[model samples]
Target: MRQIRRLLLLISAVWAAAPLWAEGERAGDFDYYVLSLSWSPTWCALEGDARHSPQCDASEDFGWVLHGLWPQDEDGGYPSYCRTPKRDPSRAETAAMADIMGTDGAAWYQWKKHGRCSGLSAGTYLGAARLAYGAVKRPEVFRKLPREVTLPASVVEQAFLKANPKMTPDMITVTCKAGRIQEARICLTRKLELRDCGAGVDRDCTLEDALLEPIR
Candidate 1:
């Protein structure tokens, strides 16, 4: 009886230690999507400039760019890196997303990590990503800034709400990283309609004054 109990305990421990997005999780099993929009200038200021990324070039004029459309579980844990039968996107396919994603590599990575979990083919997933990106109206006020500035992170969220009247505070989250405004993540249904973010996706940055770099 002691040996049997020990074996049962071992099995329970293994189950508890397993990650949320295990390798074999079924695709298209998530409840909603989190559309991440990264602020290009902040990325450049944080890491892109050091690497001399092309998106950081003055001529690029990139402001808010699609980071990824992620599948999320309503509870808190989310799926990632799920197995999919779809073939990987080709160079041309990924490159086409560079205009809005900042780089082809970013597009490819997003497909590998998140898109695969959507249970859609690479082409279809990329197309859905584009549609989701276009659905959000990026605020033009930030684009017109002539120089860097510091402001409350909530102000960023408010800007998005004001620009998108359909979006409520629960549907959007502003995040800060390394003292800079990083990204604005908005929740959406599978059909690309605005929706409230899940519990795990509702974390908003609490920075009183976060630095925002002007578009380069």
Candidate 2:
């Protein structure tokens, strides 16, 4: 009994330290992403000019999400710079920013947005805790500066593209953005639809689409 108790305690500690997205298959009907993990103030910046508005004003703070599993490389995918415990070799700039902004005593969790309950099987992480950076107002200098940030959708698309670069743009990209943004008036964009499950399928017939749509 003492040994069993010790094992349970150890398991609890590890589970508490790990992100919820660390395990499980995120089907479109139900999926999850990490909103931010160890995000730092210096990490705040616009990733790129918005696709529609290159010069438009925006700022983004980036972090990691283990899409299908923990230590993503083990899933037979090329590892992302942020997924590994160590610094990313390719994105020196992002690595630096993440480090500077990484010291906050923030805990990470995968928010489950109940899919079937909401007419969408897909669930996403909604950050319930606030970090210093999350709630603080940025100074003017910080406000307008271009920061490197990547949306979960961008990461998802990139992974697919890396695997099949020759695949048509329409064939590979999954468009997802944060359900919640900073604006009080702006409601979250409802259920993101992922296109391109495979060949010859109707673009709108994806599981995400079906799940996201209200029951008729």
Best by TM-score: 1
Q: Model 1, which residues run further than 4 Å from truth?
A: 1-24
- Give lDDT tens digits, candidate 2, residues 1-216: 999999999999999998644233332322221112211221222222333221122343333211121111212232121221221122333232232233111111111222111222111211212221243222232233354333333333344345434433443323222321111000111222222223221122112221111001
Model 2 vs. true fold: TM: 0.18
Q: The CA-based lDDT of model 2 is what? A: 0.26
TM-score of 1: 0.88
- Residue lDDT tens for model 1, 44-64: 988999999898988899999
Error of 2 at 191 (Å): 31
Q: What is the Å distance of residue 84 in model 2 from its true position?
A: 9.5
Which pairs clash in model 1?
none
